[model samples]
Target chain A: MKKVLGVTLGILTAIGGFVDIGDLVTNALVGARFGLHLAWVVIVGVIGICLYAEMCGRVVAMSGRPVFDLIRERLGPRTGLLTLVASFLVTLLTLIAEIGGVALALELASGVHYLLWMPLAAFAVWLVIWRVKFSRLEQVFGLLGLLLVVFAVALFTLGPDWGQLLHQATRPHPIGHENWATYAYYGIALFGAAMTPYEVFFFSSGGVEEKWTRSDLVTARSNVFVGFPLGGLLSLAIMGGAAVLFLPAGIKVETLGQVTLPVAVALGKLGLAIVLIGVFAATFGAALETALSCGYTIAQYRGWQWGKFVRPREASRFHVVIIVCLVLAMLTLLTAVDPVQVTEYSVVFAAMALPLTYLPILIVANDPDYVGEEKNGPVRNAFGLVYLALLTVASAAAIPLMIITKGGQ
Target chain B: MPGESGRVLHAQLHLLDRQLIDQADGHLAGKVDDVELDLDADPPVVTALITGRERITARRIVDITTAVTVSVEDLDLDYYDDWVENHVIAKIPGARHAPE
Candidate 1:
């Protein structure tokens, strides 16, 4: 029973931590516009992240250093710093978007202006970071994040034709009224959302923060295999919810309100309430993840002491970075820019930032000094190399696609 | 002790720029900024492990007392800038490797 509870908790957190503002917006946007023509991207992205995150966990278990530190080690400082800056900004942008997401969820729940809720939401996130124990923080959010299963519940209750949804997903082409460019653009966005760089950063660093050992590799792997796929399934459920309601009605998902409309349509006020809680926990959890990542990237690159495992004073530099980042993110949100737009650009940047983060992990996973006897087996290396190529293509095409599609129009 | 087992580390590849964790306090003091080697020996010996730290200066940014630095003078990272720029970052156009 203890083992089962551990696996369940790890999976819940992974699934909860999985759907940040990026996944919520991108999957919904794509499903509404393209109607599962790009569902394959979510599947591909899930497998890619599973393969990607597993290596990061492996490296942490072996070397006790997280992926960001490994990024500097494998790539020299100049290149590493370059990678660090790009990934850092992407993470910062994600932090901004997630704060906005939490605020939006609070607004939906309370009917207060999301802008009014922004400061309090950010403060709550900061306080949690400053005081909460690492495991407790993760468990609280992870369990609460499972509240997102309401999306699945709503999708089932909506009584949409499962055959039609699966058929739409299996078909490889865009539906009418949308061009292939827009479809491809959202494909990249959805893929980016599913495999954001912060997830890997949080996973590996969270491993070290929790003091993972060789014995804990199973726990980590279970988190990836069990938790992530379930989270990816939730993303698809959001996509399905959009496909069922918005596509036929010719509605576009441009706001958090629109994203949750299908839930309200299917399950009424109770469903709406439950889904809102899930959104709050998931976004707030991801907000913490991305904010901590901002500190992790800079601190790890500069070799500053970093982690929540140490006393607050011990990792003062890391704490300072986190506080500074949260303030900057809140200021960005204060500009009243649309959080959905932030979510869109952030994920595209995430796709662009992928190769820089993952290449080093793949390279170091094969290094004897790092992984030793636990180095990548042929199956893992094969998947790693394939994802490397795909990531390169996505990174190369992300900007051009954004420009050509006018940010997916 | 890096060379104690008769194991040789490629200077640029392995030794330089790794995080420096101090054994006494076990804080990540800094990174390996430069390694002083005695090539005069038959097998070179790593003589000094150099780590230069940038002073943590608190700047009032947006009314927050935050630590910030813009100088490398405090760091012994002089050798890396030249070598990494020419060999590593310089070789890749735009300092980023993207297949057009």
Candidate 2:
């Protein structure tokens, strides 16, 4: 019973950890603009993330090495350095976007400009990464992020025609003469949001920090299988709300507040307050994850000591990287660049870097040299390979689709 | 430094760049940056694994005499010396007991 409960909690944390600013913004925006037509992309993205995350988690549990460590071993120094540069840039971009996202969520609640809160947000994110224990960080933010159930609650409160919602989700069509390029562009964005590389990095590294062993493979599997899909469900609820409330009114979701407007409209002030808390927890948690992910990727690649389990002064370089990445992200946000636009752009680039980050995990996981008796089973290998192919397509098309659709117009 | 039993069999495949693991608690030591091959044999054999950062930098890079050379060459060599323990890393501060 205790084992079951622990596994269940791990799964729940994964679900909450999965949804970040990208999914909240992209899913709602796409659902509002293109209706449920791009819903298929979310499903694809979730499957890809689950498969790769599971492989990476398994690899960590078995080998006690994180994905980036294996990436260095597999790619050698020069290519690994290249991977580190590209990945760090993309992860830094994501960190900046998430920092801006947390501030925006705070802004929605307090009515201050998000730009004013950016520095504080970045500092708090770094402090938490520096001091908070891995499990404590995940638990506090993960469970609190469950407040996003307001979207699910709002769906019931709005009492939408389920038949229509289901029908639209099943039969995806671009709404009202939108071109397929625009549709495909949003599809890539949604896909990118679901499969962001940092999640896998954070997940595998977190497994290592938590000291997950081969026996804990059950815990890891439970987390990826249950947590991610349920997290994806929250995204779907947000999309559903936007589709029901915003689409009918010809609205396009451009702001974080706009994404929560449906809950406010459907469930009033109480729902809006809950939605704000949920967004705060979600984005704040993601900010921590991505910031630490930046530190983890760099330190792991270079074989430096990292993790909050160690004292701050002991892992100076790791903490230094986190601080530097956070400052850079905050500085980027201070440029008054639209945070939402930055998020949209980050997710698309996440799509482009997907293969670089995940393919290493897939290769390492299947290596008997790494996992010994626990390499991927045939079925898992087939699933991973097919998803790898899909990721390649998504990655190949992400930039071109962005250019063609002018960042989804 | 080569013992009768511990000579380099294949430097690239077996020793160089492989992760050094402490035998006692399995905490990571460091990567085998480069090896010192003893010339006192019929053929050269690896004698000691050089695992420090300064040693690695000097061995890996070609031009160590550039404008940036002073900082790398001079900055407190003591810090790099104690970082990667020779042979095993079981003596590191946190490696003994299971982390609480």
Candidate 3:
């Protein structure tokens, strides 16, 4: 019974911890504009993340080293340093977006404007990282984030035509008057949202924080396999709800509020209240993850002691990096940039940065020195190489697509 | 180093940029940023691990496998770490306490 509960808890957290501002905004916007036509991208992304995250977890379990550590060892100093700078900038951009996301969610709940909430939200995120135990912090937000299941419930309540939705998903083309270029652009954005690079960084570092060993491989695999796919289902549910409520009415999701409207329309005020809390928990949780990932990437590359397992004074450089990142993110949010715009660009840039992060993980995972007898089998390598090819195409095309579509105008 | 003195190892493949773990407290000290090599030896051999972009010799190295484990009395490689801990991080309230 205890073992079942433990496994259940891990799965629930993975589901809740998966979605962030990028997933929420991109899925809703794409759904409203393209119906379910781009849903296949989300499916592809989920599989990609599950594959790489499993490798990252396995490496950490076997070697007691985080992803960035392996990145440096495998990529060497010059190329590794370049990758670090690029990955760090992208992760920092993600951190800024998440901070803005928490503030936006706060504004949705309080009606006080997101700018006023930015500093408070960032401070609270830092405080939790500074003062809370790692497991406790993860569990609290992960459980609360489950409230986003309201989207799935609301979609069923709306009673959309299941056959039509299935047709759109299968067809995978631009809907309405939208052209192929914009459709492909949005598809890449959805893919990027689902497989953001920071997720792997946070996952491997969190594994180390929890002290995962070879014996924990089964638990890690279960979390990646069971947890992430279910989380993707929730993303699809959000997209489907938007397609049902916003597509026919020609409503585009320009704000976080629009993402919640389907629930409010279907489930009324109680559902609105629940979904707001869900958004808050999910965005806030991601804020914590991205902030720590900024610290994790730098600290691991430089070989500074890191993780919430240590006292702040002990991991002083790591803690300092987190503080600095928060301050910068909060300041960027204060400039009144649209959090939604930040979310869009961050995910696209995340797609561009994907190869830099994952290629090294794939290389290191196959190295016997790191994983010993647990090195990648032929099947894993097959999928890994295929995804590597796909990711490279996405990375090369991300900027050109964004430009051609005028950032998906 | 714990390996046999005559053991053959490739410097770039085996040593460069590997993580340096302080075995005493099991904390990460730094990375092998560069290596000091004895060129007079027939094929040359690494004499010390350079860390923190400085030329400090990692004289206390205990093992050299995937990661290099060293037993240093003081992790002087982390000058920035000490300065930040004392002047910045320690000044914050509850800095000395681990999260509950």
TM-scores of the first chain across all predictions? 0.98, 0.97, 0.99
Poorly placed runs, candidate 1 (over 4 Å)? B1-7, B53-100
Q: Report how far off residue A325 is in candidate 3 (Å).
A: 0.8
> What local lDDT does model 3 show for residue A161?
100
lDDT of 2 by residue, A232-315 (tens): 889999999999888888887989899999899998999998989989999999999999999898877765667766655545
Q: State which candidate, 1 or 3, has the greater TM-score.
A: 3
Candidate number of the best DockQ: 3
Q: What DockQ would candidate 3 receive versus the native complex?
A: 0.81
Report per-prediction Cα RMSD to one decimal.
Answer: 9.8, 6.8, 1.4
Query: For model 3, how does the per-residue alpha-carbon lDDT over A1-409 read when each residue is reduced to its tens digit?
Result: 8867877898999999999999999999999999999999999999999999999999999988899998898898788888899889888999998889888888988999899889999999999999999999988999899999999999999999999999999997897889998998888898889999899999999999999999889888988999999999999999999999999999889999999999999999999999999999999999999999999999999889899998999999999999999999988888888989999999998888888889999998899888999999999999999999998999999999999999999
Q: Show where candidate 3 strays beyond 4 Å.
A: B1-6, B53-59
Separately for all candidates shown, the number of backbone clashes (residues 3 or more apart, or on different chains) is 0, 1, 0
lDDT of model number 3? 0.90
Estimate, for each residue in A1-409, the C-alpha lDDT of model 1 and write its tens digit. 9977887778878888788889999988888988887899999999999998999998888778889888887788899999999999999999999999999999988899999999999999987887777898888888898888888898999999989998998998888888888887888888789889998999999998988888888888999998899999999999999999999988889999888888899999998888899899989999999989998998898877788876555565676778789999999999999998999999999999999999999998898778879999999999999999999999999999999989888
The C-alpha lDDT values of all candidates are 0.82, 0.77, 0.90
Model 3 residue A261 lDDT?
Answer: 94
